[model samples]
Target: METWGFEASNVAVAQVRIEQQLVEAATRAGLTNLRVTTDSEVETIGPTQWLGAEVQANLLWTPTFAFLDALAAWPEGFRVTGFQYEMQPLTPLQQEAGMTAPTGSVRIGVAFPVILPPTAAAPAAAGAGS
Candidate 1:
């Protein structure tokens, strides 16, 4: 195999897309100097859910007063969950698990993402249940 300039995983791609969306929205809304990033891992979430997918977005910026006020009052699904930051910088186990095949190892995490919309999820959910 080959390791080029970072071949992003499914979750990574999703995170990047989400980041872009947020950034674009913020930019359009006239927010400045904000940075958003996301990453996912289930094993470290505790209680180990095989079918669970968790995404963590780190918003690293102290917004201006106007930006904050605008963000608070703005509508149209900001969906930030929370404003406070969480410290989830990739554990060693997670790094190891990501690098290896999951046949004989044990670092529990979600293998695939489960996205929304009844139409889109129907087929995949049905197949998965079977």
Candidate 2:
């Protein structure tokens, strides 16, 4: 991650799984599966933790979650593996939709690689003697 210069945070090991979603028309026509998936797993990682301050790299972005979710089920150190952001007005979009909610080109999402603290299972584990 350092080599790429993209900041890495809350480092942990993550497992990623992929699934395909087939739209109704495609299913009926036996066509290819749609790229869109309803699976929520794409939005989150689990069973993760935050690294100690000693190991922190002073990253620009840190893990964050809703207040309630943080109290109940937030990972120890949630960090985004992928993200998108933009700045735009919310009122016009709301007026167009006849509803009030945040909207814009900007968006942020977390997918997979919810890093966990290194364990002793690996051959070159952290803190292992050289």
Candidate 3:
């Protein structure tokens, strides 16, 4: 599990880029059974509003070095808040399937921030009263 901070032109653009980066990084890291999902949020301060999002990815058979490699691939404005890992003995089915090592899942939480343009009403057309 990991957390990230990002800045983009807009929320939609940010979501697309984040998803792309995550999938690419995961592929490079050799993470199997990768699954990704995202949740969005908004925060306002004074006249400013910020778009926020969280990406959660689940994976199987992720190694330490692989995780590090994926972490390194992220560009600036991104960071890892924390991670969680658990290992358990393989079940009979898994054993028969030739699985040797412990199996577990990973959940990655990534957050993004984007500044939206200020909303305003349109001005009246000229010559309307002329």
Which candidate has the highest TM-score of all? Answer: 3
Let me know the TM-score candidate 1 reaches against the reference structure: 0.32
- Stretches off by above 4 angstroms in model 2 are 1-13, 17-64, 71-76, 79-84, 90-97, 105-130
Q: What is the lDDT of candidate 2?
A: 0.27
Worst 10 residues of 1 by lDDT: 101-110
Return the lDDT, model 1, position 130: 81
Cα lDDT tens digits, model 1, 80-128, are: 3333433445567977778432212111111222232234334543565
Which candidate has the highest lDDT of all?
3
* Whole-structure CA lDDT of model 3: 0.52
Comparing 2 and 3 on lDDT, the stronger one: 3
Residues 20-52, candidate 2: write the lDDT tens digits. Answer: 111232233322222223222112113332221
User: How does each model score on lDDT?
Assistant: 0.35, 0.27, 0.52
Predicted structure 1: lDDT: 0.35
Would you estimate the TM-scores of all the predictions?
0.32, 0.22, 0.58
Q: Cα deviation of 83 in candidate 2 (Å)?
A: 7.3
Which residue segments of model 1 deviate by more than 4 Å?
A: 1-9, 42-78, 84-130
Superpose all Cα atoms of candidate 3 onto the true structure and report the RMSD in Å to 1 decimal: 9.4
